[model samples]
Target: MQITVIGAGAWGTALAIAASRQPHAHRVVLHARDAAQAQAMQQMRRNERYLPGIDLPAALTITSGPLDALLPSARAEDLFIIATPMAGLRSTLQALQGVPASVAWLCKGFEAGTGLMPHEVQAQVAPQLHAGALNGPSFAQEVARTQPTALVAASPHASVREALVQAFHGSALRVYANDDIVGVEVGGAVKNVLAIATGLCDGLDLGLNARAALITRGLAEMTRLGVALGAKAETFMGLSGLGDLVLTATGDLSRNRQVGLLLAKGLSLEQAVTSLGHVAEGVYSARTVHQRASQLGVDMPITEAVVALLDGRLKAFDAVQVLMGRGPRGEAV
Candidate 1:
């Protein structure tokens, strides 16, 4: 099997490495946008910048080239994983327009202006392609290190889900197939925004009781927005929804959570982002998530708080105040 992974960021490189380790001697190609980055990874046998300390598998082919060079060679049975951030998803899908491969993306956020999920962006830019998404609570560094990780292969198409399972399911990585693309995408995207709120809650030295309450309530917000967009309510209980929210909200390796932590420590938004050196999806998608929720008549108070905090309209303390001050309501999904 031939599997090509585009985007050489930490998540991209980690997935490429995981696929290369699959039993079938799968031909895995990891693409870097910059020729110099590709050369460096090739020569060093490591993605030093994004995935440090983990050696790239010798069987994995690292390439730097135009989309024409890569897409034209992809056959119908091959799989393409677009590992770029949400902002790059449109262009990446456009580049793969006529490719015969079953496609999936690793990004987890709405497009900034369109407020569309990854699958939505794919539908708009390359509706002709068979595409899905790979998402869950797993972190890239752990996956790259060959640790046990489980992820969802979400697509309305059965073949796409099977292709993903065949390519990535292994001892170190467990891939579960699901037909709920909308639910999976919504769960993955909204969790990032909620993670920021959780981080802020933790950074404020709030009690564990507060943290637990935030995660539970955050899941309600995610499920509401997801269902409003036509997703299955049950999907929120699965890996992409509740599982991902728990991990991203509490895990130290989470970049979105880090953004909130930095803010709580008194750093300005610019300083917090610049310090991370990586894209925190929450910082970019908070506003869009809030907008989409409002459009759907879904009340996402936590998302609104995150948007306010990110926009500098409210300080960390003030954001908490806003959330705590909301009128008491029945706990409902």
Candidate 2:
């Protein structure tokens, strides 16, 4: 029951806390990529950059690399959760090239260079490892706060899914198992882009009418792209897809929404991101996912608009106008 969670971001720190609650009291290690960050988390008992003031469990150890936690001779990992961001997943995996099996990823974004989902990227880099993805509407803050949350643990391998359910599920956290890894991964990643569109609506001071329209239509596009990428339509309606979309778009804690609001109020993308003091996955994913959607012939107007606004090619208001003016079609289209 030894668990190693790689990454020191808000979500990663939250996972460390969650692991500390395991009944058997697993050896939970949080790997901070930055050595200074690791030392700070160990001393302050908080990820001061993101989730501050939350005390960490004494059993939750922080380290800088795989050598510190997953070394073959050292304390081995019975369960390793790769919670690192999408940008560093490949490099992180590469660093653990000799890592043992039973590794899972908590990342929920598509890779930038190849436009691949986290699982796809994982398979490409290390094809032999058993991998699963944990995804849903759950937020890091809520998870850290022990707010009740539900998420799906999905993998093509049945054993991996069941093991994940056993390791993470408990009273405050619920885990559902499924074989549709692509569906869950796609749903989780695309919701971030849709959240950006919702943020723009909020920033513009638009009424509920506009926000409602954007959310509904954004779901449609997300499903379209997800299905085009080999995911199930029903999966988009499940926790990873619809659940995440609604929570992130409407929740006050969403950085994606904050970014959109900032841009709507005349702040540059750089300024907005700087003010947030944390990376908003949607801001970067919107551009990458949008490009992949276009090449796949999936209709993603909302994603397109967000990309335009981020690229400075179109204003937020203009993007809305474009959405409204697009050729009228049936609701299903």
Candidate 3:
């Protein structure tokens, strides 16, 4: 199988390396938008800016060029993975229009202004394409190092799911198939926002008991919003839902978690984001998540607090107080 990953961020490069190292020797290409970055990776055999310590497999092809020129040779059996950020998904899909390859995205957030999920953007830009999402708890650095990780391949189309499994499932990577694209996407997007809340809880010197309670309640918020948006309630208990939420909310490598930690330390939001040098999706998506949930009549108190925290409307302590001050209700999810 021929797999083309159309971005050279940490996650994109990592997956390309994994696919290239497969025993069957599938052809893998990692495309970068910057010509210099592509040239540097090709010559050095490493993605220095992204996966600094990991070496790219000799079998992996690194390339850069116009999207149109590069994709003309794409065949129906080929697979294209868009590894760009959520903001880039629409333009990338527009460029991939009419391509025969099965497509998937690695971005895990809603588009800022439009508030559209990745699948929704794809539907508007390239509905004819066979597409899905590959998401889970795995971090890019760990995946590039060949650590054990599991992800879900979610799509309404069977061919998209099968294509992702064939391209990525391997010794260190387990890919599970699910047809719940709505659930999978809701899980992926909302978890980042929840992770910010968890980070704040930890940074405030809250006990593990608080951490555990926050995560459990956060999962309930995610499930309620997802179900309102046409997703299965049970999907929240699965990898893309609970698994990804726990990992991002607790893992030190999580950028969203880092944002909350920084905020708890009294750093301005700009300072925190600048210090990390990476996109913390939760910071950007929290308000949108809150908006969607409110529109759907779903109660997402944690998400609301996160949005307030991110927007400077509430201090970290005050946000916690607001959540803790909610009116009593029967325990349910």
Candidate 4:
């Protein structure tokens, strides 16, 4: 299998390494925006920016012009994983000529305008192609290093899903197959926003009690909206949903959580984002997700608080207070 991964950020680069690690004859091609970075990866056998210490596989190739070079010649079962940010998804889909027979999205976050998941965008933009998503409690650094990790590759077709499981599964990576692509993609994307809330709580030194409350309350919101969108409830309890929610909320490797840390350090949201110098999906996702959840009448206090905090309408502590102040009711919404 020849796997082409678009984008060369932390997660994208890591997925490339994971694909290269597959036992079958494989060529893992990565598209990086920076030609210099691509050239360096070609020479150095490592992604200097994202996975610095981890060694890239020999079969891995990095290219700056993947849209022109890789997308034009995509063949059947030649998996193309778009790991780019959500903002560019539509345009990239538009420009690409040869849509691979099987496409996997490592990208998360809703489409800015349409508020669609990666697979939803794929269906909308390229209806004829087979599409799915790769997601879980995955941190790019750990994946690049071949750390024992569990992830989900979800497609509507069980056969297509299994092929990806077989293509990428190895001793270091534990892959699960599912038909709930919506649950997995939505879980992976929305968790980042919820993670920011927990991250803020932790960074503020708000106590373990506060953090626990936030995570528990956040999961309710996540699951509620996911179910509202037609995702099975059990999917939320699996790796892609609750598993990812817990991990990203507490994991130090999360960019969204790190942003919260910076925010707690007295820097404003804008200042914190500027310092990170990378795309944090949570920031762009917060407003749209909260808006959509509201339209659906789904309970998402954590998301609402995150949005409130970002809009300067709520303080970090006050966000928690706001959640706490929600009228007394039963545990489940």
Q: How do the predictions measure up, each by TM-score?
A: 0.99, 0.95, 0.99, 0.95
Candidate 2 lDDT over 56-148, as tens digits, reads 887888888545446574322377788877888897766565666577888777787788888888788888777788889888988988889
Off by over 4 Å in 1: none
The local distance difference test score of model 4 is 0.83
Candidate 3 lDDT, 1-333, residue by residue in tens: 689999999999999988887787579999999999999999999998987879999899999988887788999999999999888999999999899999999999888988889999999999999999999998999999989999999999999999999988999999999999999999999999999999999999988999999999999999999999999998889999999999999999999999989999999999999999988888888888888888889999999989888888999999999999999998798
Please give the clash total of every predicted structure, in order. 0, 0, 0, 0
TM-score of 2: 0.95
Clashing pairs in 2: none
Candidate 2 Cα outliers beyond 4 Å, as residue runs? 65-69, 73-77
Candidate 3 TM-score, true structure as reference: 0.99
Per-residue lDDT of candidate 4, residues 100-201 (tens digit): 557777777887878887777777777777777888998888888888999999999765687678768899998999999888877987899988988889
Can you give the lDDT of residue 19 in candidate 4?
81
The models' CA-based lDDT, in order, is: 0.93, 0.83, 0.92, 0.83
lDDT of 1: 0.93
Candidate 1 lDDT by residue in tens digits, 1-333? 699999999999999999998889679999999999999999999999998889999999999979789876789999999999999989989989999889999999889999998888888889999999999989999999988999999999898999999999999999999999999999999999999999999999998999999999999999999999999999999999999999999999999999989999999999999999999998998888999999989999999989988888999999999999999789978
Error of 1 at 257 (Å): 0.6
At residue 66, give the lDDT of candidate 4: 41
Against the true structure, candidate 2 has what lDDT? 0.83
Local error of candidate 1 at residue 270 (angstroms): 0.6
